[model samples]
Target: MLIYSILFPILAIIAIIVFFFRFRSGKLSLSSFFIWSIIWIFVIIFSIFPDSSMVFARVFGITRGLDFIIITAVVLLFYLGVKLYYKLDKLEDDVNKIVKEVAISNEISLDDEEEK
Candidate 1:
């Protein structure tokens, strides 16, 4: 067996354990845990049986199994990155709005200060 076949599965198992712990600790939501588990499980499965990925390559018209896996990983990562970027932008806008409201509400007028 190829070394990566063994190494990848081992690494994937470690990742799954981390995800499980995070889920138990409430650091990861159920939906996120499920998604990450599915991804890692696939990694373990495919690494152990590299030929299984060949089926996907044939169906997708990819020239090689490794190519298919790389392409899929790239696409998934790009989608996740875009989602994160949008979420972060929304959070920044929300924080700015809240800060502006708080500042306005807490402001002390010059006339009020002079009267003190």
Candidate 2:
């Protein structure tokens, strides 16, 4: 209990600081920043009110609060993992496209120089 009281708030604060830096540096968009902010806020709330999970679990037909928390965390992590995977795939495709374009342009220039 004491550990939870200390760790969760600290984690939440660190997350908020990171979000602010990312947003300010333009690494994160406004909508993404807000979404992450809300997620961290939920973490803080649940951490402070741990027993609330019991109520939530009952509503969801879960047998135990801890089980509910674990399940929710797993689902959230899986969703985030999938989202990151897609983003990375898209970034890789974009980089490949740019590289191909540059290579083709350079080869054409070299050919033109040889002709001249």
Clashing pairs in 1: none
lDDT by residue for model 1 over 1-116, one digit each (tens)?
A: 99988999899989999999999999999999999899998898898888888898999999899899999999999999999999999999999999998777667565577789
TM for candidate 1 is 0.86
Residue-by-residue lDDT tens digits, candidate 2, 1-116: 77887799889989999999999999999998998898788778778888887998999999888899899889989999999999999999999999999999999999999999
For every model shown, what is its TM-score relative to the native structure? 0.86, 0.85
Q: Model 1's lDDT to the true fold?
A: 0.91
User: How many collisions per candidate?
Assistant: 0, 0
Q: lDDT per prediction?
A: 0.91, 0.91
Scored by TM-score, the top model is 1
Which parts of model 2 have CA positions greater than 4 angstroms off?
A: none
